[model samples]
Target: MRNKVTKAIFPVAGLGTRFLPATKSVPKEIMTLVDRPLVQYAIDEARAAGIKEFIFVTSRGKSALEDYFDEAPQLEQTLRKAGKTELLEILKSTNMDSGEIAYMRQHKALGLGHAVWCARRLVGNEPFAVMLPDDVIAAEKPCLQQMVEAYAETGGNMVAAMEVPSDKTNAYGILDIGEDMGAMVSVKGMVEKPKTGEAPSNLAVIGRYILHPNVLRNLNRIKAGAGGEIQLTDAIAAEIGTEKGVYGYRFRGQRFDCGSKAGFLQATVAFGLARDDLRDDLETYLHELLAARKAAE
Candidate 1:
C-alpha cells in the first residue's frame, strides 16, 4: 500500500516581475483575490486534500507572505471584544498550528525544480503534493483533492493535466501519452515548453502534482532545461521509464494563471461574480463597463 500524501510544498519564491510595481511592496502570493489572498485559497485546497504538513519555499522580499499565515492576535482580540463572532471565526481559520508549517529559503532563483528541492530535508522520502498558488483553480471539489482521490488508484506519480489549445502547447510541459483512459492518461514522456509546432501532444501539465520523492533525486541530475532554469518537468519526466512512472490527471476545474496581470483581473472578476453577496452588483458593473467600451469603440 502507498503511504498517504500528508505533506504539501508551495513554491512562492518568484519575484512576480510580471506584476511589477504592485509586487514591489507585496508578495504576489498575498495579493487578494476578491477578498482572500491567493495563498489562503491554496492552503484551503491543501487542507481539503488531506495534507497534514505545509511547506513553503520562499525567497527574499517574502516576509509578508510568511506573516499572512501567522496568527493576528490584536485583530482577533478586537473582533472578539466587539462581539463579532463570525468575523472572529474567519480570522481563526488563518492560523496554522505550531509545527504544522515549515518555511525554507530558496536563496537563488534557480527554478521550480530547485525551489522544490530546497524543501527536500523536510519532505524526506515521502510522496508530497506541490501547489502553485498562482494557478488559482475554481472547482466543485478542490483540484488537489480530486488528485488525491485519483492518486489512490495509480500510486506511482501524478501531475494535474489539462487540455490546452494545440498552438498553446509550447507554453506548457506537453505530455507524450500512452493510453487514453478518459480523465486519466498514462504519460509516456514530457516535453518542457516545446518549441512552436514541436509539441508532441496538447495535454499540458498544470501546477498541482502528487509526486514521488525520486523526482527530487532527479532534480540533482538536471542542470537546466528551458529558460536556463532547473525545470520541474525534466525531473518528473525522468520517472517515465522507472518503477514510479508518471500519470496525467485531467482535473475538474477552471484554472486561472494569476501570475499575469490580466489573469489576475480575470480571476478577481470571476470570483467576485461567484459570490452571492457581490454577484448582482459586480455583474451589473461589468455589463456597464462593457457597454461603455463598446460605445467608445
Candidate 2:
C-alpha cells in the first residue's frame, strides 16, 4: 500500500520582484485575489485534499505570510460582541490550529529544489504534496484533490500536466511521453525549459505535485541544472524509470500563473466574474471598457 499523502510543502520564499512597489511592503502571497490571499487559496485546496500538516518553506520578509494563519483573538471577540456571525465565520477559516502548520526558513535564494529540500526533515519518509501558491486553479474539484485521488490508484511520483503551445514549451518542464493514457500519461523523461524546437512533447508540467520521498533524496545529491538554480524538475526527473515510475496527470481546471502581472489581472477578472455579488456589475464594467477601447481603435 502506498503511504497516504498527509503532508504538503508550500514554497513561499521567492521575492516577488515582478510586483515591485506593492511587494516591497506586502509578500506576494498575501496579495488578495478576490478577498482571500493567494496562500489562503492554496491552504483551502490542501484542506479539500485531506492534507493534515501544512509545511511552508519561507525566507525573511515572509512574517506576514506566517502571521496570516495565526488566530486573532481580539478580532474574534469584537465580532462576537457585534453579533456579526457570518463575518466571524469567515475570519475563523483563516486561523490555523497550533501544530497543524510548520515553517522552515530558506536562508538563501537558491532555487525551488533548495526551498523544497529545506523541509525534507519535516516530511520524513512519507509521500508528500508540493503546492505553489502562484499557480492558482479554478475548478469545481480542486486540482490538488484531483491529483491526490489519482495518486491512490497509481503510487509513483505524479505531476500535474497541461498542454501548452509547442512554442511556449521552453517556458515549462516538458514531458517525454512513454504512453498516452487518457487523463494520465506514463512519463519517460522530463526536460526543464528545453531550448526551442527541442521539446519532447507539448504536455508541460505545472506547479502541483505528489512526489515520493526518493525525489527529496535525489535533491540531496543534485547538482544545479537549467538556470543555475537547484531545479525541482531535475530531482523529480531522476525518478522516471525506477520500480515505480513517474506519471503525469492532466488536471481538470483553468490554471492562472499568478506570478506574472498579466496573469494576475486575468485571474482577478475571471474570479471576480465568478462571484455572485460581483458578477453583474463587473461584467457590465468590462463590457463598457471593451466598447470604449473599440471606439478609440
Candidate 3:
C-alpha cells in the first residue's frame, strides 16, 4: 500500500491584496465566515481527513495566522471563572498541540507552486496533501476526506475537480479526461487557464490536491508559466500517462471560491444559513434586502 498521507501543506503565503486595506491588517485566512475564521474551517477539514501534521507556508505579516492556533490562556481563564464549559471547549478546540503545527516563510510571493515547495524538507519523500484555505467546502463529508478515501484505492496524485461553465475555463486548470470512472476521472492531461473556447474540458480543478513527492522535483524542470509565477498545474501536468498518473475526483460538496469578495460573502450567507442559531434571523434580513432592491428597481 502507498504511505499514509499524514502530512498536509497549507500554502497560505499569498498576500490578500484583492481585499485591499482590510487584508493589510488581517490575513485573509483569519477572516471569519460568521464566527469561526476561514483558517479554522480548513483546519477542521484537515482534522476530519486524518491529517496528523499541519505545515503552513506563510509570508511576512502573517503573524495573526500563526497566533490563531496558539492557546488563549486569558480567554480560557475567563470562561472557566464564568463556569462556561461549553464556551471554553469551543475555544480550546482551535488550539494546536506543541509539535502538531509547523511554519515556513515563503520569503517571496513566487506562486502557489513555490509556496508549497517551501515545505519540501518537512514533507520529505512521502505523498502529501495541499489545501487552500481560500476554498471552503461545505459537505456531509469534507472534500479532502473524500479525496483521501479515493486516494487509498487509486494510489496516485488526485485533485478535487468540478464542472464549470465552458466560458470560465480560462480562470482555472482544465482537465483532459481519459476515463469516466464513476466518482473519479482518469486525467489524461491538464491546461492551466487556457484561453476561451480553447480548453480541453469544462472540468476545472479546485484547491484540494494529493500529490506525489516527485511533483516537487518536477518543479525544477519548467520555468514560470502564467502570471510570471511558477504554476502548480504545470508540474502536475508533467505527470500525465506515467505509472502514477493523476485522477480527478468529483467531490460531493458545495465549494465556495473564497478567493474573491463575492465568493466570501456568498459563503458567509450559505454557512450562516446552515447554522440553527443564525438561520431564521439571517434569512429574514436576506429577504428584506431582496425586497428593497426589487422596490428600488
Error of 2 at 3 (Å): 1.5
Candidate lDDT (C-alpha), each: 0.93, 0.95, 0.94
How many pairs of residues collide in each model? 0, 0, 0
- What's the CA error at residue 92 for candidate 3, in Å? 0.4
Question: Taking the tens digit of each residue's C-alpha lDDT, what string does model 3 give over 79-134?
Answer: 99999999999999999999999999999887999888889899999999999999
**Looking at model 2, how many pairs of residues clash?**
0
Clashing pairs in 2: none
Residues 113-196, model 2: lDDT tens digits: 999999999999999999999999999999999999999999989999999998999999999999999999999999999999
lDDT of 2 at 195: 93
Task: Flag the better candidate by lDDT, 1 or 2.
Answer: 2
Question: In candidate 2, residue 216 scores what lDDT?
Answer: 93
Candidate 2, which segments miss by more than 4 Å at Cα?
Answer: none
User: How much is the lDDT of residue 284 in candidate 1?
Assistant: 93
Off by over 4 Å in 1: none
Q: Best by lDDT, which number?
A: 2
